[model samples]
Target: MKIISWNVNGLRAAVRKGFLDYIESEDPDIIAVQEIKLQSGQIEIPLDDYECYWNYAERKGYSGTAIFTKHTPIRSFIGDFHPAADSEGRVLGLEFENVYLINVYTPNSKRTLERLSERLEWEDAFLHYVQQLNAIKPVIICGDLNVAHQPQDVKNDRSNIGNSGFTDEERSKMTRLLNSGFTDVLRHYYPERDDIFTWWSYMKTVRERNIGWRIDYFLISDSIVDQLEHFQVDDHIYGSDHCPMRMTINLH
Candidate 1:
């Protein structure tokens, strides 16, 4: 099955920029979207054959996530981290017969590191949530993780060392996740590939120069690594600052 993860920046703007056309061309079985920046009635996405699940942030035009799948899941849940108040709408979990698919939009640490503490807390809570789900079944986690885990993940690593997304603390959390029996699928396939990135700065020539960061990912429990068929970064397809990252796995 082909699964794709993209941070669309804003659902409405993405549609105007040929988002549907791209989807049709890729034809992924499941597509996970982050940073949708829309509420239920604000925009209508014309996905004829996909079952759509959305988690909208309480604050309008802010962070949000959605999943569009060709096959309906056996069960789905909105939030697993904090039950009572999941106002940020960062996660959408879909349970199939074999695996639990989690589409996440991790909170950014902000340029000034103002939200670093909250982001760290979120990393802990989110990891706990994933661990719980993995205890039941293997988990497939995908979306914008918000941190570039290592120097290899972002261009100009030295310059970006202490930046929000590249901070030591943030990168350590990602390392912890990977060390906790999850495979970073893309890196598993292309361990030596360089200059391949997912999210680019919108500055005039950043994308052209390939000065980008691979913040988005497709991670799965180590037990399922052998089922992974293909892992890719579609850097050419772009609507938001972030492009699409995809993976294919044989569930059977």
Candidate 2:
């Protein structure tokens, strides 16, 4: 199955920038979206072939996540173990026949690191939440994790050190998460490649120079690693500061 994940930044703006056109072109089996920035009844997107689910933030025009899948889910849920952290509607989970799929939008620690502590807490709780699902069946995760986990993940690793997304504490959570039983799908395939990046600064000439961070991800349970087919960062597509990523895998 082909799955595409994107941090749209804002679904409305993204649609104006050709989001639907891109979807029509790629025709993925599943689409996971982050930062939808909309509330219930605010808007609707027409995707006739897929069943769509959304978790909207309590606040206006803020964090949210969504999933569109061709196959029916056995069950679905919003939020994680920590309901307080989920006010922003960051986690949305769907259970299918073979796997539990989660679309997540990890909280940004903010430029001044004001929210770093909270972000870290969310990381731990998120790990706890997914581990429980993983125990029942292998899980498939996709979204913008907001951290450039490794030096290879960011364009200027040294200069960006201690910054919000690149801080030691933030990266450590990612490391521990992977160790806990998931695989960073892209890195697993191209561990040494430093040129590939998913999220770029919108500042003038930043994306043009290809100065970006690999923040968006597709992570999967270790047992399903062999079923993975095509995995890639679609830097070529545009519409948001962050680009879309694709993962195709076999469950059968």
Candidate 3:
């Protein structure tokens, strides 16, 4: 089975930029999106042969998430994080017969670190939620985690050391999560690959120069690591500053 995760920035803008064409080309079994920034009735993007689920933030034109799957899930969830409810529409949980697929848009600490504390709190709640779900079945967590876990995951790590997405605190939380039994699928295969990134800054020539960060990912329960076949970052396909990340797994 193939699964893809992307932060489209905005659904409307991405669609205008040929998002549908990209979708058709990739033909993933499931596609999860983050930062959709849209609500129902705001746009008409046809999703044929796919069951679409959306979680919209109360605030308009803000954070949101959606899942388009070729196969319908038996159950799903929007927000189950506590003490810091997923009011921004940051998470989507889809339960298939064999696994739990979670798509998330993690909170960013902001340029000033003003949201750092809250981001940490969110990490705790989100991790706990995943663990609880894992206890029931293996979980596939994907989307813009918003933190580059190591120097290898980002270009110019020295210059971005203390930045919101590269800070020690944020990276440490990611480490904790992985240590607790999730496999960072991409790294597991290409641990030493350099200059391979998923999200790029919108600044002029940044994407062209390939100055980017691998903030998006596909993580699965450690027990199912053997099922992971391949993982990739579709850097060449772009509708947003962030590109699509994909993974293939052998369900049988």
Candidate 4:
């Protein structure tokens, strides 16, 4: 199975920029989108073959998440396993026969680190929830996690040391997560590759210069590491400030 995860920034704007065309071209088995920034009944997606599950924030045009899958999951969840703070539409899950795919748009710590404490609390709760599910079945956690877990994951590691996504606290949370039995699919395959990255700033010449961070990720339980076949950063496809990432697995 092939899965694509992207922080589209805004689903409506992405569609205007040929999001549907990209989807048609890639023909992925599943698409997990973050920061949809929409409310219920706001827009109609033309996809008829896929089952679309959305978790919209209480506030319209802000944080949100959704999953479009070609296969019908036996179950789906929003805010059920996640923390109550997930009401912002930050997380959702689809339980297929073999695995549970959790799509999350992790809370950003903001430029000034003002939300860092709250984000850390959310991280602890989210990790607990993920572990609970892992005890049941292997889980594929994929999305824009909003943290650069290591120096290698960030472009300007020296200059961005205390920055929101690269802070010691934030990076430690990710480290604890990996130590808890989840494998970062990309790094597991290419641990020393520093050139690979996912999200880029909108500043002029940033994306063009490839000054980006691999904040987005696909983490799975260690038990299923062999199931992952290939993973790639699709920085070439662009519709938002962040780029899409694709992964192929042998789940079927």
TM-score, one value per model:
0.97, 0.98, 0.97, 0.97
Compared with the true structure, model 3 gives a TM-score of 0.97
**Model 1 C-alpha lDDT per residue in residues 104-193, reported as the tens digit of each score:** 889888999998998988888888888988999999999999999878899989999999899999999999999988999988988877
User: What 10-residue stretch in candidate 1 is worst by lDDT?
Assistant: 79-88
lDDT by residue for model 3 (6-73), tens: 99999999999988998888899999999999988898768788998999887899999999999889
lDDT of 3: 0.90
Instruction: Estimate candidate 1's RMSD in Å.
Output: 1.3
Candidate 1 residue-wise lDDT at 9: 97
Residue pairs of candidate 1 with colliding backbone atoms: none
| Model 4 clash tally, residue pairs | 0
**Model 2 per-residue lDDT tens digits across residues 1-252:** 999999999999999999999999999999999999898887778899999898888999998999999989998899756664468898898899899999999889999999998888888899999899899999999999999989999999999999989999999999999999999999989999998999998899999999999999999999999999899888999999999999999996
Per-model lDDT: 0.90, 0.92, 0.90, 0.91
Candidate 1 error regions (>4 Å): 83-85
C-alpha RMSD for every candidate: 1.3, 0.9, 1.1, 1.2
The Cα error of candidate 3 at residue 208, in Å, is 0.9
